[model samples]
Target: MDVSKPPFGDDDAHLRETTVSSQTVYQGHFLQLKRDEIALPDGGRAAREYVIHPGAVMIVAVLPDGRLVMERQYRYPVRQTMIEFPAGKLDAGEGGLACAQRELHEETGYRARRWARAGVMHPVIGYATEVIEIWFADELTLEQRHLDEGEFLDVFAASQDQLEAWMQAGQLTDAKTIVGMMWLQRWRAGHCQFDWQTVD
Candidate 1:
């Protein structure tokens, strides 16, 4: 399948809303959205479900030597240590750019003089509409890093070749890390064709 092309066409029928459902389930971090079953073009009632989320932000930090600055931390939910870009869910009224700046500083002890939007992605569109906005942070300087309670992570810089080796060998599994690094790499190479496809 071509990644550049979206499978479904953008048509009125594609977004056709037939039945409405009032049922809702809230779970703090996410909400379950349910719509009443409706008849499809084939004369069948299709069940539709979607998870609502507040979205998220992440940052890809780059040093002068084309090295990637990333984090290694133990994720509580996954119960494993993983590598990822500095990231977090947006606080109430917090903008994506601001969240990226704050998270990068807090997690990596690095501050960027310039920042750019990397890309926004849908991790799991089949269930959750959890879109994540990524940013690129450059012209960095090390600052006082303030870690939250129970938050433990290591920050380091590595060549993309090294990261790719680690990834191919099953070392790095975090989605944000992979996405940020890929986008940043493309951006630096001047090969990105769209603004939403890469930062700056």
Candidate 2:
């Protein structure tokens, strides 16, 4: 399938909403909330509130032994420790590949010789303007981690079978990690192809 084009052409016009007015409700160091008045397709007016984010990248790094690099960290919003792929927000003016590489190294201390962009996913389309760009990394070499200040996490490795079992047991619930696992499985099954590149 050609991913460059939208699945439906002009048929989606009826579902489109035009922004009448927009206001910033709140602004933080990383996220901005916006409230907008939109003109509905049915000639009605409505308000929409959503977050404006800088976007992020999630890395699915594989060790030489086939174990996937993972992390366990406390998420304040959910009040629970979560298992997730190495991920981080994009710094100003950073490209997707650059963000992926930096995030993997900073969070897990693993740099990859070969990398491929799997796909992008919108985890919260209902409220947030955030999208996670997924990248698959292999040929990893361990280095020193440079975690951000106040960031606390435990970096570990797990196999695909273990991840699948965790998901079945409701132990792995991070959406991006789950999606990354699906991409890995699909690639392994030869359902898709990745144009992998080597980087220094």
Task: For residues 49-161, write the lDDT of model 2, one tens digit per residue.
Answer: 99999999999998999999999999999999999999999999999999999999999889999999999999999999998999999999999999999999999999999
Candidate 2: Cα lDDT at 98: 99
Per-residue C-alpha lDDT of model 1 across residues 24-139, encoded as one tens digit per residue: 64455444565445556545567667677788998877898878787888888889998777887777788898788788888888988877786799888877878899887778
Spell out the clash pairs found in candidate 1. none
Each candidate: what lDDT? 0.78, 0.95
Give the C-alpha miss distance for residue 182 in model 2, angstroms: 0.9
